[model samples]
Target: MSPLVALVHATPAAIGPARTAFAEAFPEAELWHLLDDRLAADADAAGGLTPPLRKRMLTLIGHAVDNGADAVQLTCSMYGPVAALAGQLWDVPVHGSDETMLRELGWSRPARVGVIGSLDSAVADSARRVAEVVPGAEIVPITAAGAAEAASSGDAERLSAALENAARGHEVGVFVLAQYSLTPQWMRLEAALSTPVLSPPQLAAGELRRNLLEAP
Candidate 1:
């Protein structure tokens, strides 16, 4: 039987891109989506991950594991740290959204890494992780102004433009789109900047497939 991979999403915008990524990267795996649309708004309102919010995220992850998930992936970068806690509580492998991408970046030993995101919180979290993984490398946090609004409004052009505009001057060894919502724009962003662009979904999918499906 194909392994069932549960995707825990904090926003609806991440769903399509994540599905596309999994389909391309781990086509044989079955997908289960667990969405809490208000998760992001609640985190933003509370000025980041609060205690109650953390509990709620854990509950969702637990539910996914209980429902026969072979592994779980959190699609929100803001609540990424919660994955670690969830891993302790569940027997299934639980993964934070950007872990694989950040790990790869660390292996590359880039001199400077640019983290681009629609939300400042997500960018900051990703930048912090980058710092942890690549201590000697410079971390640049770029908040794509208006990109969140554009994404919410379903304005792809505006989203791409905002990201491009924000990323215009920064010349980094590699660029990381910190939010899963920004994954769909990675190709365009990479082409415009002429640099390697990394996003979470595809990398996470591949990692999960390797660990769960290909492991001997």
Candidate 2:
């Protein structure tokens, strides 16, 4: 039987790209998607993950485990803290999509890490994650104004242009696209800049496969 990997998403934009990454990286694994777009809104309204939101997140994670998921991937970057707690509670592997990518960047000990995100909260949250991984590392967070709305509205070109503009001038060792939803625009951003662009989906997929599927 194939391993079941449950993907938890807080925004619609995350679903397809995450599925695509899993398909490309671990075709043999069974994929399950769970989405609650409102979770993102609530988190934003409350200025962070409120207790109720965290409870719902755990409930969702438990539901996935009960449904026979061999592993769970939190594909939303904003849910990092909740995901970290869930990881602790689950015996199965639970992946915070952006965590590994940030950790990898942190190891480089870069003087400045540029972060671009569609939402202001996501940018701040991502910066926190980076600091957690690399103490004292400088993090520069950029809000890709209107980019999220463009992506959600299916304006890929506008989204691409906004992201490119946000990342155009940054003298950082690496530029990290803070959300998995922004993964598709990675190449466009990369081409227009000299800095390395690190997006979470592909890295998370590879890490999930290695940790959950390939582990003995």
Candidate 3:
């Protein structure tokens, strides 16, 4: 039997590519994309989740359960509370975008962590991961909204500039791209000549592979 998972996409973003990467890792499960209009909605520069976003996610996950998804994976790293609450409300194996990052952090690093996101929720995700993993490590979070916008429009140059701006003060440090939204242009940003970049898509995909493969 094929296990099905619902991919609740809150933004009008290219999250499918990231999920495809995850799917390649878990060939047995079928992936579904469910999008709500809320993704096009803008975030306050402060980057926190607005009520629109919370409601959006709630509605999307509800739809997923109706569709009979065996599991639900909310792919946005920024929606931390939403991720936990949705997992509990749905009673399934809900995967948060940053959950893998934290688990991986436990296995690695004492380096300064630079987090990249187009939204505040993503910054929070990386900071939370660093806090849980690095312990007293400096976590610098930056938003590449312009980059995200360009990526949606298929402009890699604009995305690169957004990364450059977000790259400020990340000298010689480890960086994590917290939002799956900025994932397409993730490679455009230069963290630090000395720092290694940590990407949520790659991390999340690996996590999905392990879980789906090991689960009985």
Best model number under TM-score: 1
* Model 2 residue 67 CA deviation in Å: 1.0
Model 3 CA deviation exceeding 4 Å by range: 39-47, 50-52, 187-194
lDDT of each: 0.90, 0.84, 0.68
Q: Which ten residues in a row are the worst by lDDT in model 2?
A: 102-111
Identify the superior model by TM-score, candidate 1 or candidate 2.
1
Could you tell me the lDDT of residue 108 within candidate 3? 79
Between candidates 2 and 3, the one scoring higher on TM-score is: 2
Which residue pairs of candidate 2 clash? none
Candidate 2, residue 11: how far the Cα is off, in Å: 0.9
What is the C-alpha lDDT profile of model 3 across 1-216, one tens digit per residue? Answer: 777877777575646556655655566767888876455344434366778777777788888887788777776665656778877787767777677777776677656677777656556656776777778777776776586677677666776678767676666456777766666555545432345666666676666756766768
Q: Name the regions of candidate 2 deviating beyond 4 angstroms.
A: none
10 residues in a row with least lDDT, candidate 1: 117-126
Residue-by-residue lDDT tens digits, candidate 1, 1-216: 999999999999899889999998999999999999999888877778999999989999999999899999999988888998887888899999988997898788899999998887778878988999898999999999999988877788999999999998998999999888888888999999999999889999999999997899
**Per-residue lDDT value at 208 in model 2:** 80
Q: What is the TM-score (0 to 1) of candidate 1?
A: 0.96
**Against the hidden true structure, what lDDT does model 2 obtain?**
0.84
Order of candidate numbers by TM-score, starting with the best: 1, 2, 3
Best candidate (score: lDDT): 1
